[model samples]
Target: MSTSTARFTHLNPGFICENCQREVQPLKVGCRNHCPFCLHSKHVDRFPGDRDNPCQGLMEPIAYEFNGKKGLTLVFKCKECGGMGKNKAAHEDEVQADSYELILKLNKPKS
Candidate 1:
């Protein structure tokens, strides 16, 4: 589908996470792309809100990059295709505490 059409068709639905087995709810503030519990995302969107990608891979959270303008963005690596994607962290996320802990652990400097 064209990018424009993709955006118009995009729907955020509550899903049972394939990786963590959690019943995730739709985002109250925005689109729900990732599991708020494990911070893992599916390889769905080719562009933000454009779920045109067909990889259907499990995306693992790899690292965190903080931008002054954007706050925090989580980096993800797809297990099946070895592709990477980054998504901005949400403020009203249900699993914010755990998410922050994971982000801190991943973002720590190497010794």
Candidate 2:
């Protein structure tokens, strides 16, 4: 990730983005910072679906990856936590599933 992206952190309990001004909530769909109307998610995770995180920070969603009949996907990474998690984007989230795919060649460490 670039220096600017390295600063990613998950959005926390805060008012909606002034840019996309709208009411926001937490976990009821994880809308703490993202503007529902704008579909802006924070970056705060390190791996897809791995949430046993120490990074208690905001996660910015870079884009969506579709799984074969599984569902829409959310790609994430946290700046503060360095934790990444991938989730099946929900129906409501699908409304904003507008995303571009990235074939990033991240260094895969020994598992």
Candidate 3:
């Protein structure tokens, strides 16, 4: 296999979303870092896309940040170990079942 393919093969191709229990497919644009539906991720990466962490925790989406030309990046907090991580929002996330609405609701301004 090519180096790029080899690198990608090291990452988790896809998984059943823990938060939402949905079968998530590998992202067409890049590695499947988080669930498009619930924006949750596994605590498997010590570095981005490395999948070397041993925590095996469920990462919950806590907040989001604007990434200018790249769009939004969702921040996650691992429920098991309290570690944190961030992932760029997939364009598919906006169209994933109820994800768009939930994301909007979660992003509502706080009083």
Candidate 4:
């Protein structure tokens, strides 16, 4: 089997934020990729919920965009590999919603 396939594991487990050291709970509806408090994520998945990425880098939230369908999406850049990815903001989640204030802070107009 390929590395990605062999390493793939569908997961939505709660974890402690590496950036802020906050205990994060799993999403009530779907996978919770980043910390709602700091909006930071680890580069651990090649595909969403598939913990197969080897980078294992700290992903920094750099920007945010709103879509009519997806609502708010946060853009991230991997600190280790310099890769980029986007994840839908969970501002409406019942359990641990993404921080709306932080999202707003990131959604500033480019100057």
Best-fitting candidate, scored by TM-score:
4
Candidate 3 lDDT over 1-111, as tens digits, reads 344755545454667888889988776555667887777888988888878799989998888777667676778899999999987777553334326665665553243
Off by over 4 Å in 1: 1-10, 94-98, 108-111
- CA lDDT of every candidate: 0.76, 0.45, 0.73, 0.85
Cα-based TM-score, every candidate: 0.80, 0.40, 0.78, 0.85
Model 1 alpha-carbon miss at residue 107, Å: 3.0
Clashing pairs in 4: none
Tens digits of per-residue lDDT for model 1, 1-78: 443554445476778889999888777656767777788989988887768899989999888787889777788899
lDDT of 4 by residue, 1-111 (tens): 243564454466899999999999988776788999999999987777677889999999999877789777888999999988788889899988899999898856353
The parts of candidate 2 lying over 4 Å away from their true place are 1-22, 25-54, 91-111
TM-score, cand. 2 vs. native: 0.40
**Cα lDDT for residue 19, model 3?**
80
lDDT of 2 at 102: 22
Name the runs in model 3 displaced over 4 angstroms.
1-12, 93-98, 108-111
Q: Pick the candidate with the highest lDDT.
A: 4
Q: What lDDT does candidate 3 reach at residue 47?
A: 83
Clashing pairs in 1: none
Q: Predictions ranked by lDDT, top down?
A: 4, 1, 3, 2
> Model 2, 12-74: lDDT tens per residue?
354554435665454444433344444444442334322334545655555556667865555
lDDT of 3 at 60: 88
Of 2 and 4, the candidate ranking higher by lDDT: 4
